[model samples]
Target: MTFTEQLRQENDDVFQKIFTHPFVDGIGRGDVPKDSIIHYVKADFEYLNAFMKIYALSMVKAKSRDDIRFFFDQIGFVLNDEVHPHHNFCDYVGVEYEALQSSSLPPTADHYIKHMMHHAQTGTIAEIYAALLPCPWTYLEIGQELLKTYKPTKSHPFYEWITFYADEEVERITLELRHRLDQEAQDVSQEQKQLIKEAFRKSCELEWKFWEMAYICETWPSEQEASRI
Candidate 1:
């Protein structure tokens, strides 16, 4: 099997959990709570900021012009094309898009962003690809799988959000990333391949945790009596 295939196989358990998560299922069923989506959008907005930064760092580490352009184009896609989903969520729920810009990162999101940044900043191109693949890859898979089971009507609460990720462009982008990672793995040492594997798996786990974080609306505990620090 190819490297990308192996990565998917190894992480199938986590991907299954993400697919079956209440947040995802609710979106498919059009019954998700607005407050949960609000929390998810806020946290995910922060996550996307970190994601773009990692893409920039990957551009710096990229060995070929092709790889650099790949990252650059993806950054553009996120900045220009991906906002529709966030807007859909906010507009439906009566929240301003601007509010997401100022939202704080939930603890799980913070950890996941740090995880990707660590590899982007310090790892080889191969490892960086491995670390980053899970986001787009799994999201596209989620969208595709969800789409397979239910076709959202225009009036569905998450119609735009679901269709956005299920778009052909999203699938193309994911396949491109998978191809790039598989190509990068072709020349790496065995030890390097292991590092890539580990990064990929950890990222898969974080992907699942991100949904759980939103489902539960995670936050740091209040220190009510310590106001005057």
Candidate 2:
């Protein structure tokens, strides 16, 4: 089976859950509350900041200029075209962009960001790719499926967000990166292959939790903090 197919086979449960998650399904139906989506976008903005860092580090790890350029291009798009536009949506949904900027990262977002950064900084190029694949690839897949399920309308709050992931250029980039990672994996030892798969699975798990974190609007526990006064 193709590596991408294997990834789907191994993570089928998460694949199903994420696509069918109430938050995701609601977005497709245009029924998710504006406040709920606003909550999600705020956390997502913080997540994308770290996502760009991983892409930058991966660029340093890449040996080929083409690969390096790919990573660099991803960073540019995520920061400039992909993620930043959410701020406009946030404003429309009652989530202030400046407020999200000042806010500290919540518990789940902090842990997930740290995990991705750790792998991105320390992992081999292929490993870094494995760790980073779930977010973009899954989002792209979700976007494609949702576009089929519900035709885009300007009235739907997430139309632009949904449309971004489904863009042909973005889909092309995602597939190209996936093929590159799978090709890189072909020469690695079985142990290393397992490690890469574990990274893939763990990253998928984090993606799953991130959605839950948004659904619940998870925050750092106030009572858990030590009292200074």
Candidate 3:
């Protein structure tokens, strides 16, 4: 099988675990309190907008052809679908663009965005891919699994939204990004491969943290507080 197919298989396996994960299942099914999920979504939206700004700036600063290409590919997707008419995250969260533009998010959210921007600006194109790949990869994996597991019925409020993100479009994007990464990997130095692995590992951790944060935000007490209780 091709490298892309292998990556897809790996991603699929990981996502199966994620979809059945108690935490993911809880949030996806709206078992979490409404207020908490709203808070998480709102905060995430604010962070997303800030992330977009930093991403744009980083792309501007990208010196190498590969770096510029990676930045533009991501920017195009965000602008064309994720942020605009095709799939407005703000709209999904019931927040107006103006509100998202004006609002401040949690420090953790800021840190995550900053980390991604820093990698994009200072790291190699491969490094940036290592950093940025987790979010969509994780989402797509969970989405595909959810598609299989969660039968869409009237009871599931966000079924359509969930399926949309995890469906064909997300799968296509995942394939595209993985292909780019594998191609870019060939050009990177051996030392950079280690760095990319470290960065990718960190990126994955951060992604896990992000989801945990969402779960915490969706629950009344923080995860720590919940644990203590």
Best by TM-score: 1
Off by over 4 Å in 3: 1-23, 54-73, 83-101, 218-229
RMSD (Å) of each candidate, 1 decimal: 2.1, 2.6, 5.1
Ranked by TM-score, the better of candidates 1 and 2 is: 1
Question: Which candidate number maximizes lDDT?
Answer: 1
lDDT on C-alpha atoms for all candidate structures: 0.88, 0.80, 0.62
Error of model 2, residue 61, in angstroms = 1.6
TM-score of each: 0.95, 0.90, 0.72
| Model 2 CA lDDT for position 167 | 85
The residue pairs in collision within model 3 are none
Give a tens-digit lDDT track for model 1, residues 1-229: 9989988988899999999999889889888788888998999888888899999999888888988899999999998888899998898889898876868887899999998999998899888988988988888988887788888789888888888899899999989989989999999999999999999999999999999989888886552235445
Q: Candidate 2, residue 158: CA error in Å? A: 2.0
Per-residue alpha-carbon lDDT of candidate 3 for residues 129-213, written as tens digits (9 for 90 to 100)? 6667767788787666666667665456556556767778777767676777787787768798777766666656566666566
